[model samples]
Target chain A: MPGVKKVGQRTIQFANPPVVMATASIVGPKEGEGPLADCFDKIVQDTYYGEKTWEKAETKMLAEAVEMVIKKAGLQTGDIDYLFAGDLLNQTISANYAARQLAIPFFGLYGACSTMYEGTILASILVDGGFAEKVVAATSSHHNTAERQYRYPTELGSQRPMTAQWTVTGAGAMLIAKEGSGPRITHATVGKVVDQGIKDPNDMGAAMAPAAADTIITHLQDTGRKPEDYDLIVTGDLATVGKALVEKLTQQQNIDLSKNYTDCGILIYDPSQDVHAGGSGCACSAVVTCSYLLEEMIAGKYKRILGVGTGALMSPCSCQQGDSIPGIGHAVVFEMS
Target chain B: MGANEGSLLDKQFQQVKKQAQQQQYQQMAQSVKPKQTWVKNAVAAFLVGGSITAFAQIIQNIFQSAGLAQKEAGTATLMIMVFLGAFFTGLGIYDNLGKFAGAGSIVPITGFANSIVSPALEFKREGFVYGVAAKMFTIAGPVLVYGFVTSVIIGLIAYFFQ
Candidate 1:
């Protein structure tokens, strides 16, 4: 309790804020063709990205992102104290493999799509506690790898339902330092695992919306802030269906989020992209935040922003066994002032 | 909106969320409820199915003329067709044929072999035990169970009647 500030039960207000020094985003061909293509640092035209398998390609992209962010921050790989990485693959092989290549002390996290923010929270905590000078927070997902692992093989050419979201193929990395000239993480709210007995994996947007709504309400309560306090409120990978649901849920709680709310899932893809619900996976929020939001913040577009990373905690086995998908949302407050 | 307000908002949030989700699922199900292409699919199935049966008859006749009994020729012909289906699936030709031929390619015993071998090939990376072996029977398992049970029932009825 030396410097720790615990707000209510699940939220924490940091005494010493950690700065996001620099960030990098890399995506595959399909993601490159999306609406936010120009924001990305590198867009590999081929999904393989000069690798033989899609898994290998994802590892390459993540490693390259880590390298890019470190270089952008004017720091060497040795300057980073720890690497926090995660991915959508089984055992998070992509992030683990990238860590192997980077040779940094690694901490692997599994929060499904919320893993990017989970990494960010851990990295920020380590820096704020004065334990680390710099930490690299990274996460990745490949369309091919996720489809085969969570759904079906690409060659099957199965028909997808309208509820199914397109797993984004990309990697996003951020270099967080103990002190820097950048946006500071002021507060964080770790959400409860909320399950509405949602069994359909295809409709993950619906499954995760409740968790996001719960977190949004709890964050405002713990911080004693209003919805209008922040310029923007972004949720991770809720897509269209979940975005609508969040709006509905928040309205019931008398929290009007209609003016400033948007989802990274909906922002990443174009309407003409035929992505059904919208873009998803760990890379959805990661790439959008690292590329789009960071640049906009630097340009003085937003002063205070709340990014809530939402995740559906269910594996293919868990979904197959008739177990309901449990959802979680973790919120982090970013401020330029 | 008071800070002291306990789980009131949480409960309300869940209730509103559940109703919204129910509505969304119903809408999604309605939107993606597959189109009625039964008549066109039936036509395709009839033509392709008849053609496969004709082809198998020709192969059985050829085997019979090669100096084998009718029963032996039929079994040998079926085995060869199954081998052909499996080989085609491995070469990535069977899926393409399934696209064009629809029910034609799938109605034969070769189609059954394709169903079993295709999943095994798809999940080969998951390893031999959990990936390939476990998933190999996903499509064919129900067929095998139902076929066995139905045959047993029919055999018992025939034996009693006779």
Candidate 2:
């Protein structure tokens, strides 16, 4: 905690807790269709980014999310002072497009799914330290959009395993303000990037679990709290497979979070919803955390919460070339006063 | 009165006879005749088909200049060329061209796009929901979903093993 500065420990109780003011999801109308269908149809519809680039879809979602947040906050575009965002796409098109439309001073960040936390942490810091009066944090993901741009075209037949998390096709945005009305982010424990360099990209959940557990355990240690201290500890986009793996591994580390720990990936997709095992994406964590969990928090359903965002640092090209995947996790704690 | 009735009947009979004569002449003119015009049709098809391929090459050049990777550019070139080829085919020009050019248009990305879209357009007449919707995704859905899932698994394995 030496590098961590305690800025404004008392003067700032977020008049509006960095609450998710609003959220939106822009899925291609062709649900259950292939990537080719979505891209082709989008091109026909004259969508600007429709040429088989996932960057386009991510950008669209980010733009939509920003629009919704601005409207929800009942504020004009000029009212916002800073925009912090990121995504998995190269160059971070989601943040870039959103920045272009919102036209505010921007900071582009990347931590994979942990991007949400990165945005949130930065916003909180800016607000608490009195650097900015109001800041908005947002992130997004798209299955076909990201896949075609990052990997291969949709027409190439490939095999998949059950252990994988479905890259979610959605986006989420949140507004953090210094003096509004919302739940304040009270405490946060930022984690170091941990990489085990696991070789398989398909089983990201398993690969990321150790880092997730490490961050969760470290956050608890630093905050001088136990697993029971927070009502719920949520990890971003660690599917059912990763969730189980994290649970088992944390127990080995003498940290048991079985009952309270859950994954955003598993929660977003109803297995009955036929989303194929669980959800995975930058938005997997962003949307679920902002929309569902924050809604519950606002309703006084959960008091103290620990939100951990996990990321797998493997590119499709590197994976296809047989390179090992490195995983990272970051944790941010939120409390309701 | 008798003279007038006879005259009117005679006029009506002449009119019927004239109509029958014209009908017979029109039938003869409308009859299908086997012409040895295959050579002409074939030549037309070839010229049109060649022009389509040339246009496709132009498009490919443009895309190449725009910084598309070779594979992507090739696919795009194929798509455009095939679509043009299909248009000429519909005009009865491509059939002749096919006989001469011999799969020149049929062998590239243009041909593949034509194959997919032509069937898709045909299916669209069946309705957007069942015909176009169901069949369109049939070819590409599994591939993308597979790529996505496999990548995730690959990412996981890489993380875990490390």
Candidate 3:
């Protein structure tokens, strides 16, 4: 059992990596109006997605994404073995309720914004280990639902700080299988929760950048690779501020990420969108990866990509009690033939 | 000093060094973080909030000119202002205004009405009794509680003095 699937320190090197069979994205009107609008499979005009409440709307979007991914793979719901998913809500109720509707064997996750990659790595491990032949990895975030739960009511006449990020109202899902002709999940490095003692809930980028840098560094060190090894290295939601910090932090460690590193938050929106720092939430990375990046990978634009899902692990309760925000970044490498 | 004491000294030194490094990281984060738009927000708040207060004064003046008592005119003006706030909130304009106005929109009577009405409208989907009624006072509850408590304290002081 020694060094069978494990890499140096805390990375998993899949001997036979699981393939991403299909991907589906369902985004809200605001996201649909953004730069990558045409990339998504479906775009709902309203944030409610025809549901009564924003919470129910988020559940619907996730459930639809899961079903769409399965259908895109030309498989029935009963054909999938496990469903790994999460969302940025209380008790992960969005994922839990969607699982109830989907009726698949489920593993409810709570990795804050980093949950999509967490689900991906776990799905890859299960598929690679021959435990589950096919499974679904998905996560969603609703702008109104996140606001009501984390900060204030959606219509509260409050101004967000310039450093504050706009949560993406969308869902992204992927079907991963043991044998498929698609981009394969090759390796992953799960990050440690790194807290640089940043306390402001508004400045989430700064809080998460250190963790992203640390995980990137460790991934490189563990796998004995360099930044040039991957065609593109993208962080989940560092936006502008955290992206700069990751560049600086990694540069200090003599690992120049200047050539290839980018952020999903920055890429998701244009400067005109006025998303201050940039787009965030679980859907930020998931939607961007499932839509834009995956399409590019299949089209031979990018062959090797290291997608780092970063998360600021502060709750409303923790921030209210004056505790510093802890951050995490989980990385998953995807390579196309 | 003995070997134990020397090792203790080294440990303390390491702790101090780590603390300094941590402080450096915090400062770096603060530096790179987008600076607060203090002047812009403050100016906008002043202009917007001041305009709202001035408009209320005009409304109060109009009621007084219509031959109402000063207290009656003030109450009527506030009611009009609250209605306008709730109206804009319902029409989905106040929150957008607030995004630019900052505290300017939030400090006025209209902002207060928006605070109460926003949650009421948002939570309406959950059910009237538990959703709207229960969540209505969430934003403005603290203001009402503290306002009443202070009034009671001042009233007690006045009673004892008299």
Candidate 4:
């Protein structure tokens, strides 16, 4: 465990690994029709989910997801040491307001789509370092809320080009305990911002592919592992195009990801469902990892897996100011118990 | 179209299929893109702009026939055109016309009136002074400043020549 302290650059080896006690996911109707629909804990039929606004619906989703995760873990709200949550809203409003109701020590994060894994790394760090006994890492995003804020209003009826990705309307929460019988967090590799001079806001896959590839390469080098080392390697939200780009980039580095690599963005929804370029949102990785991947691990389908959460760091105002989108990826290795 | 997590072979097959579909979408996007019709837009602008000028001419002639001087008639015609423009904009009819006519409606004196009253109407809910009055020149503010400054400079040049 001594050499496990630090791998190559940007990688960390936790001496005392944290365990995922329980996780839960809640998604809207559009996501309910996806391939991973059966994995979700709850699926609301309406975008508003009985709330007056999309933001409120997202807040409701995250709060309910947190409650579900704690209940599934058989832990009371007071038992949790800290709550780490975030969303796509400005000021991380959904997670912040949800935390207000949960009343736990909170850490608000904004890593765009990478928020789930980012929260995972932070929560694991706190638990592994003896800073906390238990922490909840969660993130959520509503399609309508993200659409109006990031692009045109729903009323505008704007025709999104093929390069445009559908923002996921869902929330996922995970309870990381100091010690538990679940998937063990082995190592984490945090990514740096990688900008490939991509300025088009529509082609998010292209913007984020480089970051995912960078983190994956660094993870492999630091951990002294290859593409085939793990049972599976998954990315956060780099759907079809971005996934292909990652495969190509890794291939150039003499790594073959064609066998065991998949992306959450591409896995959640079916292509025939008309989700162009697949799904992209803070909840993409969160929901997929919590619901689908965790269940598979529990079923003994995957023994060891790596999750690379990728995020596009660009705001609508920044894009209008002609700023290029920079992307980041954070990786966490999970081993089944 | 389908990604299977259980079987590695199926996952690889799905990824390969996904790559092919992506290429198809890229090509489709390029082929189906709407082309900008510059010549058509130019004709529309010219016709609508010229028709607006002709209407102003007719108004000027009527005022002249009523014993007004040429300069006074011209100024009165411009005022009438601006009033008509603001009136149509307030009725919400000008925006519809703009959608249909494109640059045709946007190249007219009505478009100038729209430049002033549209933002005012949109922001009127915020309050009168800070909202409507303040934003009244949101679109026209640059026009007024640049228009007056250029005209003053040209006037000085003309006076010096004289």
CA lDDT, every prediction?
0.88, 0.67, 0.94, 0.86
Evaluation by DockQ, superior candidate among 1 and 4? 1
| Runs with alpha carbons beyond 4 Å of true place in candidate 3 | B1-18, B152-162
Among residues 3 or more apart in sequence or in different chains, the pairs in candidate 4 whose N, CA or C atoms overlap within 3 Å are: A8-A222
Best first by DockQ, ranked: 3, 1, 4, 2
**Per-candidate DockQ versus the true complex?**
0.12, 0.01, 0.76, 0.04
TM-score of chain B of each: 0.75, 0.38, 0.84, 0.73
TM-score of chain A of each: 0.98, 0.85, 0.99, 0.98
**Model 4 docking category:** incorrect
Off by over 4 Å in 2: A1-54, B1-162
Better of 1 and 2 by lDDT: 1
User: In model 1, which residue pairs have backbone atoms overlapping below 3 Å?
Assistant: none
Could you give candidate 2's per-residue lDDT for residues B27-113 as a string of tens digits?
332231123345654565466457766777788889999999888998887766666645643444533334344445444444444
lDDT of 2 at B155: 100
Q: Compute each candidate's TM-score over C-alphas.
A: 0.79, 0.61, 0.95, 0.71
**Top-scoring candidate (lDDT):** 3
Clashes of each: 0, 35, 0, 1
lDDT tens digits, residue span B1-162, model 1: 575465788788888998786666446434533354567766766787688778889999999999999999999999988898889888888776675566777778888888888888877777899988999887788999999999999999999999
